[model samples]
Target chain A: MENRNQITAKQLGVFVLSAQVGLGVVGLPSDLVKEVGHDGWISILSAGILSTVITVIVIALLRRYSNQSIFEINRHLYGKIPGQIINFLLILYLGFLMVIGFRYFTEFIKLFTLKATPELFLALLIIAPTAYLSWYGLKPVARFSGIIFVILFFFLLLNLLTLKKIRVSFLMPVGAADLAALGQSIIPALLAFVGLELTVFLYPYITDKRNVLKWVIIANLCTSAFITIIFLVTMGYFGENLLKMQVAPLFNLARYYRAPYFGRVDLFFILLWFPLLESTFRSYFFTTYDCMRRYFSFKDQKLAYGLYAALTILLSRLPKDFTQATQLGKVVNLAGIAVFGFLSLCYLYSFFNKRGVKAPCGKS
Target chain B: MSTGMVSCVTIVVSTVTLIASLSLPPWGLGLPARILKFTALFFAALFGILGLIVTASVTFAHLVTLESLGQPYFQPLIPFKPGKYDRKKRP
Candidate 1:
C-alpha cells in the first residue's frame, strides 16, 4: 500500500538528516573526547566525510538497479536463499539497533529528568508513538522527519546560547590527539552517522531521482556541520578534560547556562528531541518490516509491524541495566560495520551482474 | 522559569508562526478559523515545552491533516489524491 515513489528527493534529505542525528549524539561528544581529547572534532568531521562517501557509493549502486531497494538488489545478485539470509541478518541488526536506541534514550531521561520513573515505563512511552508512526508507513515518517528538521533549528539556537561562556583557549592544541588515536576513534565516531545506511533501502522510492544525489550529499554535509558546531561549542565551553568527565556533555553544557525566563534548557531540548528518536525508531522498524515483507511475502504489513515491535520490546528488556545496554549497543555497532561492508560487496556484485538478468522489483 | 512563563513564551512563538503561515490574508480571515489556528499552535508549543514525545506526536498529527500542491500531507503513505498519481514513469 506504500506509494513509495511519491516522496521528493528534498524530503529524503530531511529524512537522512534526522536519522543521522539521533540518540547516538547524546553521548557522542563525550565519547569522542575520551578517545581523541581536543582533537575529537577532527574525528567527527572525518567520520562525517567517511559516511558521506559511503552514502555516495550506496546511491551509485541503487542507481544501477532503478526501482529495486537494496533488499531486492541483494536478491538479484545473491539468489533467494543467500539473499534472504542476508536480509535476515539485516533485520536482526535493525532490531538490535531499535532496542539499543530505546534503552539509551530511557537511561538518559531517567538519569537526568525522570529519576523516580520506572525505565520500562519511560521506554513504553517512546515505543507507543514510534509504533504508531511505523504502523502508518514511510511517508508519515518522512514528513515527521521534515518537522523534526525545523525543531533542530530551535535546538541549535538553544545550543548557541552556551556561547555566553565560551573560552577560546579551551579549544587549544586542536590536533593534540596523535594520529593513531584519531584513526582509532573514527569507527566509534561513525555511530553518529549510522542512519546513512537508510539511503540503501530508501533510494528507489525517491520521487525526483535527478535530485537524489544532490539532496543526499547536502544532508550529509548539513549533519556534519551541525555535529561539528556542537563539538566545537561544547569543547570550547567545557574543554576536553572536563568534557571527558561529564556524561552527556552537550546536555550538561546546556544545563549550566540559564536565562532569566527559562529553567533547565537541557530538559527542554530533551523533550523536543523525542521526535528525532521516533524517526530513528521508525527508520529501523520500516527497514525491518520491509525485509519481512520482501522475503516472507507478508501482504499484511500490520502483522509484520506487530511482530517487529514485540521482538524489539523483548530484546530491549534483555539488557538488565544501562551498562549492559551499552555493551549490547557496541555489539550492534559491530553489526553495523558488517552490514555496510556487505553492502559494498553487494554493490560490487551489482556492477558485474547483467541488466537483462535483473528481476522485476515492482513499482517504485 | 514558572509554568506561566514557559506557556507565555510558547504562545507568542506559536502565534507568530501561525500568523505567518496562514494563507488567508490578515484582512479577510474568518474569526472562528483564525481562533482555531491560534489555539492549535498554542497547544503545540505547550506540548513541546512539556516533553519531546508529546511535541512530536502533536506535530505528526497536525501534519497528517494538511495538503501541499494538491497532495496529502503524507502523500506517499496515503496515496488517495487524484491525478497526483498520473505522472509518467521515469525511463
Candidate 2:
C-alpha cells in the first residue's frame, strides 16, 4: 500500500463541495431558464438529489473494500489489462473536463472585463497555478480553499443585497411549464455537480473513510442547494432577458448591480474570481493526474504537471469560437456522463460478480 | 505584468467604445443607447471618480458634471473638463 497523504474528512467535504460549485454562478441560471422558465429552481433541486444518490453510490463502492485506491479495486474486480484500459478511458474523460473548465473561466473574463485580452494568456495564468497547487498537494490548498469559499460566500451575500430585486410577481404560481422541456435541462444541470465523483479518487487520500457517507452526501446537497439559489436569484433579477445572452448571467448581474456606497458587484467578482476558479481547476487537475498515474507509472510531480499542461493547452485550442464551444460543450457534457455515470456502472458490474452485493443503481 | 496587461486591455476597449458612443450621439442608437445609458448611471454610483466620465462619454448627450477634473490625478486625461474655481461647480 502506497502512503498517499493525510487530509481530514472536513477538508475533503469542503474541497469536494467547492470544486463542484465554483463560479457555476455564471451559466447555471442561463441554461436552466432556457428550459423550465421561472420554475428553473425545481429542476436544479431535482438534479442535486440525483447527484447525491450517484455520489453516495460512488463513495459506497469505493468504501466497500478495505484500504484500496479505486485503481486497485479496478484491478481487483476486473483483472489487470481490462481494468487498466477502463482507467485510461476514464482519465481521458477527466482531461476533457480540464479543458472545459479552463476555457469557460477564460471566455468569461474575456466577455466581461478584458474584452481585448487574449484567452491563451488567461488560460496560462490559471493553469500555471493549478498545476503548481495540485502538484503541491491538498492540505496547502485546503487552507486557502476555505478562503475562496469565504469570498464566494461574501459574493453570495451580495445577492442578499440584490434580494430586493426579486419580483414576487415573477415568482408567480406555476403559470405554465412543460415537463418534457424542464426535463431537457436536467442533463446540463447535472454537469454543474460534476466533481462530486472525485470522492473515488480522493478516497485513498482521506485519512478516516469512516462516516465518509455523511460528508459525501452533505457536500453534494450543499453544492446543489447553493447553485439552485444562484440560478433563482440571477434569472429572477433579469428574467428571460438572460436566456438570449451568450455568457455569464452573474457577471451581467454584477455589471448592473449597485450599492449605496461600495458600488458594482463586478469589482468584487474580479478581485476574488481567481481562488474560486482555482478550486475547480485543481479538482480536475489532481483527479486527472491521479487517474493517469494509476494506469501509467509516473513518479515525478514535474512530469505530472508537464503532461497536464500540454494536454490542456492542446484541448483548449480545439474550439475556434463561442459557436463552436456550444456544439462541443454538449459533447463534453456527454463525456461527463460517461465518466461519472457509465464508468461507475462498469465498476458496479465487476463488484456484482462476487458476494452478490445488492445493486445500488437498481435493476434497469 | 499580468495585472498591467489586463488593465491596459480594459482601458483600450473602454476607450474605443467611448469613441463609438460619442459618434452615435445619445438619442440615435435607439434602445441599446438607452440601455447603455442606464447601465452607466449604476456604474456612476459605484465606481465614483470614473463613473461620471463613463456616463458622460456613453449615455449623456452633454458633457456635464460638477465633479472635479483638475485634481492632480485627474488632469492627465485629455477628454476631461478641468475644474472651475467656483465651489458651486464641485460635486
Candidate 3:
C-alpha cells in the first residue's frame, strides 16, 4: 500500500475536541471541588492554562517537524535504533493510556449502570466499537468526533441552565479554600487533559498542517474553558461537598430535574458520551498504531487489536476492587505521561533539529 | 466494499471470532494480544471477538441478573460508602 497520509482541517479540530471531552468531562471535576471547595473552578482554569501552555509547547515541537508525525520525527532526529527506542517508549506510554482510557469508561459504566457485572465485560463492551472505528481509519472517526463535540458542549449548556438551582451562598468565599489540597489537585486535573498528546502523532494525517497551530490552540482553550465551566456549574448546582460525593456530578446535576418531560441527567450524559468514547479510543488506537508501525514495523492491524484487548483486560483487572482502580487511575494524572519521558523526547527532538519540511521558524 | 466481499469477510471473520470470544475466559486473552498490540494497531478479527465478548457479557449478565450492575462491578465505589441513591427512596 502507498504511504497513506491525508487529513482535513475539520478532522484535526474534531480530533482535538474528542481528546478534550473523553476523560475530562466525566471525572476531572470531582477532584477540583474536593480539593479547592467552591474555587475548584479556579484550579480547573489553572489546569487548563497549564494544558494549553503544554499543548502549545508540544505543538510547536511537532510543527518544527511539520511534515512528520511524532514517530517519523523521532526516527529522523534520533536515527533508526535510538529513534525506535524513543518510539517504543512513547507507544508504551500511549498504550498505558489506552488501557486506562478503556478502564475509565468501563469504570464509569460499572459505577453507574452494571453494578453486578464483571468490569471485563464493560471494558470489552466499549472496546468492541472502538476497535471497529480504529480499523475504519481516523477521518471517519474524526468526523463523528466533530459531531459529538457539538453535543458535548450542548450538554454543558444544559448543565449550566441547571445552575440557577444552586445557592449563591454555596459558592462564596472562593479563594484558597484549601491551598495545599488544591495544589495537589492540579496534578490530577492536568492528567484529565491527557489526550493533547494525540495531536503530536497526528501531523501526518492533517491536510493543512500549516493551520494546525491556530485550530489546536483555539480548540484547547475553548475545550478547557467549556469543561472548567461545566465543572464549576456541577459544583455550584450541587455544592462542592455533594459534588465530590458523586461519581459524575455533571450527570447528576443534569438529572436533578423537576420538569414533566425528563427524569434523569445521566441518560443524556451517557447517550452523548457514546460517540465521544468511540473517537477517543480511535485516536488512541491510531496514534499507537502509527508509533508501533514506524518503530517495531508492526504492520498487522489485527495484532494491534489483540494488544489493546489485553491491556484493557489487565487494567480492568488491576483495580482488584473499584476503589483501588479509581485511586490508581487518579494517580495516573495528566502530567503522568510527561513524567514517563514524552516531555524529554519533545525537547530532545526539537533541540536536535528534526524540523519539518516547512517548519514554524524555518529553523528546523 | 462490495456487499459480496463484505459479507464474505464478515462470515469468515465472525466464525473464527465467535469461537475465540466463547472459548476465552475473562482476562484470559491478555498475553497473546499484548504481543500483537505491542507491535502495531488492531486487526478487525480480534476487535470483532472483543466486541462480541463485551456485548454478550454485558447483555447476558444484565438479562440474567436479579439487579442492575454499576461501574467495574468488582471495584469499590469512591469514598467506599454506599450512596443513599444506591437504594431507591421509600417515597
DockQ of 1: 0.18
Which residue pairs of candidate 2 clash? none
Q: Worst 10-residue stretch by lDDT in candidate 1 chain A? A: A355-364
How high is the lDDT of residue A169 in model 2? 56
Ranking by lDDT: 1, 2, 3
lDDT of 2 by residue, A1-364 (tens): 2332456676678778778876465677777777677777778888888887787778767766665666666766777898777667767777777777777766765666556556776566556556655555555444335545566677678778789988755655663677887677778788778777677777767788886778778888888778877777776788765554636776666777886655656765654565677677777777787677666777785776697687787788788887676666677777766767764685577556543233345553
Count: clashes, candidate 1: 1
Interface RMSD of 1: 4.6
Instruction: Point to the candidate with the largest lDDT.
Output: 1
Question: DockQ for model 3?
Answer: 0.05
Off by over 4 Å in 3: A1-5, A76-79, A178-183, A303-311, A334-345, A352-364, B1-91
Candidate 3, residue A102: CA error in Å? 0.7
Per-model TM-score, in order, reads 0.81, 0.74, 0.72
Q: Select the stronger candidate by DockQ from 2 and 3.
A: 3
For model 3, report the TM-score of its A chain: 0.86
Residues B1-91 of candidate 3 have per-residue lDDT tens digits of 5555566657778888777766656665766545544322333244333333344333322222221353322212311234534556423
